[model samples]
Target: MTQKIEFIDLKAQYRALKDAIDARIHKVLNHGQYIMGPEVRELEERLEDYTGAKHCITVASGTEALLISLMALGIGPGDEVITTPFTFVATAEVIVLLGAVPVFVDIEPDTCNIDASKIEAAITPKTKAIMPVSLYGQPADMDEINAIAERYGLPVIEDAAQSFGATYKGKKSCNLSTIGCTSFFPSKPLGCYGDGGAIFTTDDVLAKACREIRVHGQKRRYYHTRIGVGGRMDTLQCAIVLAKLERFDWEIEQRMKLGARYNQLLDKHGYQRVKQRNDRTSVFAQYTVFVENRDAIAKQLNEQGIPTAVHYPVPLNRQPAYKDICHGTVTAVAERVAKQVMSLPMGPDLAESDQQRIVAALSEAVKIGGF
Candidate 1:
């Protein structure tokens, strides 16, 4: 008989939180304040305190959160936002949507984050901000990125879509930058039932700007204060997150412990893992690894009932949609990683036995492929 393994076991998590989640949903149903409801404010406060950010503005989605942050910073036409090509398209998409150019920077081969060393060289008079993605739940070198941004007087936006619960140098990922945006797209570290996201910031002015932007730029009823978007988080989603928070700490702990265990097992078995910087803690959003015959290995794992995924099969620079939008040439590291990276089953609810099974399958796959 074959044992079933999931790429991400969300059902297991739901089972664990059924009662709390049901109660929260019932509360939302009773209130009937779905849009920008009281639960929205409550979730925002909780997230703000969790991230140590001065303010948190919940939004419709992570994409909207990023767009609103860009709008808040006035990063519009003729401006340039420096970023990495290894990230999801949204990082660059929001830039283009605001009529700003995305200056693609190279990434560090190990961390797969925007190379802070290469950032200074990319700076130009048009550079408005440095947007570094915390790819795969590990934060980029914000200290170095922030230093470069400060030198050029540019704001830093951390696209922390995969790293909401991550930490760097004893500080949270979202709190490290001028502005941070995260998603609650169910697969994320702190996901809700449906689409949701939030913006974190220490700057009071930017916080206020983001709040206004999230509500169609409304400062008051029927009064447009500034250019904004319809990006409010739903009350039901907020309620779900509020309930998830009850066990979030424990869930983060489980992810960290399991991620470390995967690292150990893979290393002992001669599999290469995605490198996490020593200065930070990753929540193992995907538990990715690099393999010699990545596609063949993934297929073999699937044959054994061990599910796997690729965070990205292609680099943004090589994608059809991004082929012509380049402000610079593609980096060699990002290009190489796109073909080699594979994500194994990972989630807080993933059992130790299931993880061992995944490792064993991968080990066998490696031998089968002559790796």
Candidate 2:
């Protein structure tokens, strides 16, 4: 019997970086300033420099990053935010949580990202922001989206949870729009041991607002300036990220090379996969491909000791919570793609042998399942 392939191989990564990770964690344990230790500021400064963003505010989680950004922008009741319907719920959840409305937009059929061309028509008087999610670590068309937002006097937020190490038109993903947010969840391209996230922006005012908002909206030690939440990224998690950053560049390079290899194999096997644009690089948070009878294919692959997953099976607009909110909204592309998409094992540490096996299993599964 062959060994089972792991999806999002964090253990392999940990084994490789044990020395650095252990040292970093030990330092944090010794300091005892777990709340907001020196490592916190150190990691923030490093990320700010990495992305060329003037400010990088580490937050509790990816969801909090989006929520805080919306709060800082003064998005409240009756305001509308135009965003893609095919994304993790957090993108729209943050908008709706603040008493605002999330206007659903269809995605590009090939890339599965927000359709920038259709965005302009969605603008209305109540439109407060445009949030585009970089699905599967590939960025949406940021330049066109930004231009549209500028024309309409609206801010654009790049939900870059999966695209942290990715680049778009020579710039980093988390620094591409008016405000950018990313996650450090264990499966992300650049992840910490546990939940962590960051927000990036060049605007000083927005930066200050985000910092205050993360700390109960306090400008000083206990003087609350605005309503806020307890959303600070713990120092230990920051320290873990700092250690991971040591080899992040190499990891990113591996991801790109492996992603290209997967694409080649899939294409050779006559499988359809997500298309990455020439102007950008995806970290390949999940190397997903399209198939008919996705559930049957996944079941066959699992039986063959190949782990398969779905980035999402349901578009947010079609969910019970959002269906009524986006009533009568048509997102044909997103709905169709959701049913066909299936993710394969993907990570910086995935071996070429494992990738070949995954592709081979997928091919067999497709044949066996008669799809």
Model 1 clashing residue pairs (backbone)? none
**Worst lDDT 10-window in candidate 2:** 321-330
Tens digits of per-residue lDDT for model 1, 9-100: 88999999999999999998998998878999999999989999999999999999999999999988999999999988999999999898
Per-residue lDDT tens digits for candidate 2, residues 22-140, read 99999999989998799989999999999999999999999999999999999999999999988999998998899999998899988999999999888889999999999999999
Off by over 4 Å in 2: none
Each prediction's TM-score against the native?
Answer: 0.98, 0.99
C-alpha lDDT of residue 214 in model 1:
86
How does candidate 2 score on lDDT?
0.92
Q: Which whole-number lDDT from 0 to 100 does residue 332 have in model 2?
A: 95
| Backbone clashes, candidate 1 | 0
Error of 1 at 165 (Å): 1.1
Candidate 1: misplaced stretches above 4 Å?
Answer: none
